[model samples]
Target: MNSRKKMRGGPKKFKKLELYSRISFLYLNKAFKNPLILKVAERKHKLVFKFLEKEQADVIAKYKNLKEKKHDEVGVRYIWTLWWQGEDLAPEVVKLCLNQLKENSNGAKVVLITKDNYKDYIELPPYILEKREKGYITFQQLSDIIRFTLLEKYGGLWLDSTIYTSKPIPKEYFDYPFFSQHTKWADTCFVQHNLWHGFCIGSKKGGKLVSFAKEMFFDYWENHDVIVDYLMIDYILMIAYNHFNDIKEEIDSLPYSSERLYELVTILNNEYDEKYFNSLMEECIFSKLDWHKEYKLSIKGKETYYSHIVNLQ
Candidate 1:
């Protein structure tokens, strides 16, 4: 098996997509260039709609002029992809998850929220744009804010577009009232550590934990000067862990390549237990494409920040 995430298209050609200065010329979803790893794995579901489609750079470009949408019912089993600023959805990846959902007893719903549709879901203050422009909240920070808001408003799994789902995830993820990967706590000696990861988070709609998260996130957004995106998420989770008697974060279900996992684990201290860590190992099955394994990713155009992710549409 190839250890590296296989891809075609050299970096120079990848930069061509950004040459278009017009908004209409901006590479749309399926129409855009790929990421550092251009090829998506072959497995995919059949149905493709606006929520998940190619040829829709329009979906990502209208970042400032986003509209709002009506809220869905609570407990809807959906996977959200916030492809703001031309982040890679890699059409095949979207298909893989959708197809796998069909394989299940009951398939899940797919939701792709771009900058245009963001305001509809999240009623954030107008100043968020100012924060974005002032550089206080980067697109990354904005993503963190939106993830929490979406998870709170509509219950489901929120996967960073960078994350690719391999097989069907376990039922406990959707069933649990709340769960997220704790990047800070997983390896550290602090068994009592309360760090909570934001990359992959799942929760019940309007759930107390998520509501608390919404509050905590906005509180930090309103007051903080630094870009401690996960810090706000982590800090509030610790507070929630204490306040909510029923909510405790579960193990990370996002998989990683064993080689990469091993490399990461080698540096950690011994306080992590063998059995506990093994449980997490079961779901850590993805091969994370190191963004700069070869040449560094390039950036161009004012339309978005993530022009480097190669596309396969």
Candidate 2:
């Protein structure tokens, strides 16, 4: 009876939310003091300004001020990535971000990471620079890259795109530690092979684990690609969980509900196959029946499978 009580009490006490609260507070405090600045620097060291359109500038400015007052907790470093394509609103966003940061007592570090060639479109202020040059990528791609880079470079707890901010990093977000967390599941999820694609939450040490997992998953896919189809970060973690007892035990102890997936599927469209849907549930440890076809899962099923082979267009 005592053992049963201990087991029951252990998982719930995981304090997923509590961890998120601390991280969120740290993030919010940083935002309050240092809003991110978006700048466009040129190839020849010339800086062009005026990216954010007038309308967007006003809206962002208002948000900056409001956020400052609401999230005055700790100092944080905020950086946002901008593709040369979104040249219109870049300047305005930078100015608004800088203004808010200046108003705070702790002060903030606002920086931009951009590709090298297309620097002439906008003007850059003295504070902004053409730093951290990498190859061209879409907005989504850039966000993922920058998130991981910032985490690696600054040792920040979290990274969010320019479009969003984590006011107080949520405890649930950091619930699992790197190695132990990923290996807790039973299914294989998909993750992009790119730099920022896998394992959203991990420490520097965990980054090494990610590297190992990626290599192993790649090797497995090379030989038995058909068995698993595509490898995702979550699925890779699941595999890792299977191989590592510590991770498996921790994850098994956590509270999970199948209903969450059911809820998610109900809200999405029916672009997925029931078979693939079930596969995802089995792979991701989803306990519910609400699976959606359109949602991105670890494996390519239903819509994805059809879109690839049939050209359903």
Candidate 3:
């Protein structure tokens, strides 16, 4: 039998076509450039509206804006990640992020990944603008730029448009685990802790971890995986941790649940037996660590330098 026929034998040929069709529809509407295609594309673009309304409402209601400023003097970096439909949220996201950044006394930058008319659709603060031109770049490509810019220029915190910080994430938060010369591993290691703490999406770190994420854009050529762009930096953090044990110590020193778990597991595995480790792993699965709530509470109500600034008129 032919290769195509053999592949189709296990799963009916039409099933593959149906899957392809659904994916294509999502892409055409959500990611593609042809305005004509969006006119004929599926209803998933509605999801973008829902995401925008919910995230925007939450940000506006909770955070107050300070004076319109050209830059932050204290130099805390806030990077915003955007993919295709995410562009729809760009203006609002920038406003909200700047509000939070100003509230925290920090600088902000936006990284948009698409070949769309985001330039026309969104207006941004002077401090915030697109980092790269829209081109034939993949999710990984965009993520690399974010990491490089953060590490080299902005100091490693790419805030998503949907993510609104009520408080500041201090440098002390990253003090644990010794800093590493290896940028890739250091970033990934940090991400693993952040995700475990609920700051990111996936469980892996670095490029390898990101590689595991299923491509959402394969279905729609234009609708590349924006979600992956948000998670890519964290994914790099995981990669850094896995390859470099020294950096793990930096993450280990953090006062988060995942850090505690790491310490406990280290003791249990080292002092006890393999059986104990297995039992603990099972327990971990049943009662997964919630990093988001923990991080929120850690910085909760803490009077940041930007607190007074956020209220500025």
Candidate 4:
């Protein structure tokens, strides 16, 4: 069994309240299909758009004027993941995922960005650093900042540390300028607007999508001290897709992929079977696992899929 503790690095009191409130509203909206509630939600989105418009002039201009590059010119040379405490201190599940990523990196360099050496890779604005220092921004949020910034400066894939690779990353990913797992299962208030998974994003250097997201992250933090939502990274991404034509075009051009990225999580407790595991691998190369959950290494003296996957060589 993995014994390491998993830190959520959640936001502060006011931020938590805002986040939970939205979540509650989401549940209520689903439980009772009230048009009034839906109307209120639509109005809220309009307000957000109006607020974003005030800053849109510069960001939209920069996005439109940004130069585009070919895929091979800036293909996936690096695969980046972050574990603030460093790999040695990460939970066993994370360590295993890290190993799988490196083993199946397909000649790309695997970079584990730790808290101690993050500044060595990319620099952040003073306000963002200040917010992080004051605990106004969680490590999770900071990781999002780092992800977009790194993708903009150095073209590559940003896989959340929890992702386990079953095979070498498909070459088709490197063929696109910007690619994300656009699974229809992704849920959000802006579901129709955004389907991309932020956990697994690949971008070309100076890619329009990443550049626009980088701008939004910097702009939002600079203007507000408190986080408006827990999934702010996702919200900004959806906003970019809605507002920018080039980003939308790039996203729409990518084929549907990573359909079963979370399938392993649902069947972790099932007895390990090589045949079933092979079938799962056929669905997707990567499977998203959670370190926060306590998973047994064995059940009834037989290895669980969780154990088999974590211990996979």
Which candidate has the highest TM-score of all? Answer: 4
Per-residue lDDT of candidate 2, residues 1-313 (tens digit): 2121211222433244234333333443234222221111111011001211121233223222221112222234333333343434454333332333233212334344455532332333211121112211224433433444444333223322111121222334232333121222221111211112232333332233333343443233222211111122334444434345544454465444232332323423346566665454344321122111233322434454323212221
Write candidate 1's Cα lDDT for 1-313 as tens digits: 3232212323332232223212222343243233311221101111111111222223223221332233344445877766664335435433433333334314567666787788877788655666777777777777767887888777787766545343456665677566654443432212123244455677777666666667655654454444322234554455445434445423333222233322312322223344554444455632232222232223232211112112211
Q: Is candidate 2 or candidate 4 better by lDDT?
A: 4
- Compared with the true structure, all predictions reach lDDT values of 0.46, 0.31, 0.33, 0.76
The residue ranges of model 1 lying beyond 4 angstroms of the native Cα positions read 1-75, 87-106, 182-196, 228-230, 249-292, 295-313
| Number of the predicted model whose lDDT against the real structure is largest | 4
Q: Write candidate 4's Cα lDDT for 191-236 as tens digits.
A: 3333677788998888778888898888777766666556677667
Q: What C-alpha lDDT, on a 0 to 100 scale, does residue 234 get in candidate 2? A: 38
- The TM-score obtained by model 2 is 0.29
Ranking by TM-score: 4, 1, 3, 2
- What TM-score would each prediction reach against the true structure? 0.51, 0.29, 0.32, 0.83
**Model 3 agreement with the true structure over 103-219: per-residue lDDT tens digits:** 553334434434364345233222122212333344445444433333333333433433434344444322221222121211111223233332222111121222212121111
Which 10-residue window of candidate 1 scores lowest in summed lDDT? 40-49
TM-score: which is higher, 2 or 4? 4
Better of 1 and 2 by TM-score: 1
In the order shown, the candidates' Cα RMSDs to the true structure are 19.4, 23.8, 19.2, 7.5
Better of 2 and 3 by TM-score: 3
**Model 3 quality (TM-score):** 0.32
Better candidate by lDDT, 2 or 3: 3
